[model samples]
Target: MSLRGKIGAGAIALASTPLILFLGTWEGTGQNIVYGDKLARGLPTVCKGLTEHTSPYPLVIGDFWSDARCAEVESLVIRKGQLALADCLTNQQIGQNTFDALSSHAHNVGTSNTCASRAVGLINAGHLAEGCKALAWAPNGTTPVWAYVTDAAGQKHFVPGLHSRRRAEARLCIQ
Candidate 1:
C-alpha cells in the first residue's frame, strides 16, 4: 500500500475510535435517548422545584443542593427517565422531541410504571395524540406511583402541575 494510503487508513481508524467508543457508551449507558437540549435542562429543574414546593408533596425544606449537585441529579434523572421511556417502547426509533417529552413524563411518573402505562399503550397503539393525552391525565397502574392518590372518601387528588406537563408532552409528541 502507498504511504498516503497507510496514513489515510490510520487517520480513519483513529477518528472512528471515538465514534465507536461513544456509541458503545451510549448504548451501554442507555443514553441513546435523544433529548432536545431545552427539554433536557427544563425537566429536571421543573421536577425538582415541584418536589420541593408543591402541596401534598412531601415538603423538602432546605436549599441543600448545590448547583453542581442539582445539575448532576438532573442529569441522572433525565438519563434514567429516557432509558425507562425507551425501554417501554416496542419501537425505540423515535424523534428527538418525542424522546425528550416522554423522558420528562417518565421522570415524573416513574419509568417502569410508564413502561406499562396507558400513555405508552396509546403510543404503541398508534394513537399519538391520545397517548400524550394519557400522559397528562391517566392513572399509571404500575407500582410506586407519585403523590397523587385517592382518599378513603373516594376523592382523588391529582397533581396540580400535571396539566401543564401533559400539554408539554403532547406538544412534543406531535412535533
Candidate 2:
C-alpha cells in the first residue's frame, strides 16, 4: 500500500494492545474476578467485618447501601451452607492472619445490621444461584466457573460460575 496506509495500520495495531490490556483489568469492562483477589476485596471484607462486631451491622447496611454488588458474597455463612462457604474461603488471609477473624465473626448470630442472615441463607439455600446466573451470562470473554459437591451416592451438583459453558468440568468441587 501507500506510505500513509502503512503508518495508519501500524498506529492502529500499537493503540489496540494497551487498550485491550486495560479493558482486561477493569471491573467496569467485564468484572473478570472469578474467585480470588476481586471477590476477596469486596465480600470478604464485608463478611469479616460484620461477623466480628455484630453491633455494627445496622450501621454497615445503612452506610454502604449502594454496594449491593456484594450482597451475594455476604450470604456465605455457616448455617445455610457452612461447609461450602468455608471451602470457598478456606485459607484466605487478611494480612498476617488466615482469615480466622473473618471466620469467627461469621459465627455470631445477631441478625443486627450485618450479613449473617444473608450469608446463612445463601449457604443453606441455593440463593447465590441468581447472582451466579447473572455473572455467568455476562459477556466479557470470561471463562466459566462453577463449584460442585459430591453426594454420598457420588452425584455431582454443579455450582454455576461467571461464564456460561455447555460442558466444561473444570469447576468441579467436593463441597
Candidate 3:
C-alpha cells in the first residue's frame, strides 16, 4: 500500500477507536453516575431537604422506596432511558455534558413526551441552544415535572426545584 493510503487507514482506525470504546463499555455509565449523584444526593431542583419528599414519578417512588439503592437504581434507569431517547431524536452531534443534560431533562419528563417536545424538535433542527433552553419548560401532566407542572385545570406552576434542575441542564448544555 502507498504511504499515504497507510496513513489514511491509520487515522481512520484511531478515530474509530474512541467511538468503539465509548459505545462499548463506556456507554451509559457516565450519565448514570452523573444523574445518580444529582438525583440521590439531591439537586438544587429535586429531592431537596432531608424530609423524604415525594419523587417526581409516582411509579418509581413506591411505598418504602426511599433508600439509597432505590435512588441509585432509579437514577441509572432514568439516565439510560433519556440518553437513548436523545440519541434517537438528535440529528447533530452533541458533547457529553450536553447529552447528559438532555438525558436529565428527559428523565424528569417522559422520553416519549420529550420526543414530541419543542426541545427535541429544536435539537433536530440544529437549534441546540434554543433547544436546551426549551428543556426548562415543564410538561403539563407529566410525572416529575422537572421545572414546571400544570394542574388539572391547566394552571402552570413554577417549581423552584425543577427550575434549578433546568438551570443546571442549560449550563451543562452550553459547556
TM-scores, each model vs. reference: 0.54, 0.15, 0.52
- Tell me how far the alpha carbon of residue 57 in candidate 2 is from the true structure, in angstroms, after superposition: 13
**Candidate 3 lDDT, tens digit per residue, 57-161?**
432222243346444544555434644564456454555555556655555565677777777788778888877777765334233334656665677777676
Minimal lDDT window, size 10, model 2: 166-175
TM-score, prediction 2: 0.15
Going through the candidates in the order shown, the clash numbers are: 0, 12, 3
Pick out the ten consecutive residues of candidate 3 with the lowest summed lDDT: 45-54
- 107-129 per-residue lDDT for model 1 (tens digits): 55566777787777887777776
The top-ranked prediction according to TM-score is 1
* Between candidates 1 and 3, the TM-score winner: 1
Error of 3 at 144 (Å): 16
Give the per-residue Cα lDDT of candidate 1 at 79.
49
Q: State the lDDT of candidate 2 residue by residue for 42-140, as single tens digits.
A: 332232223323223333322432334333333333223222223343121111111121222223222231133333233234433332232222233
Output the lDDT of residue 45, model 2.
25
Candidate-wise lDDT, in order: 0.47, 0.28, 0.49
What lDDT is obtained when candidate 2 is compared to the true structure? 0.28
After TM-score superposition, what is the CA distance of residue 161 in candidate 3 from its true location, in Å? 2.6
Worst 10 residues of 1 by lDDT: 11-20
> Model 1: what TM-score?
0.54
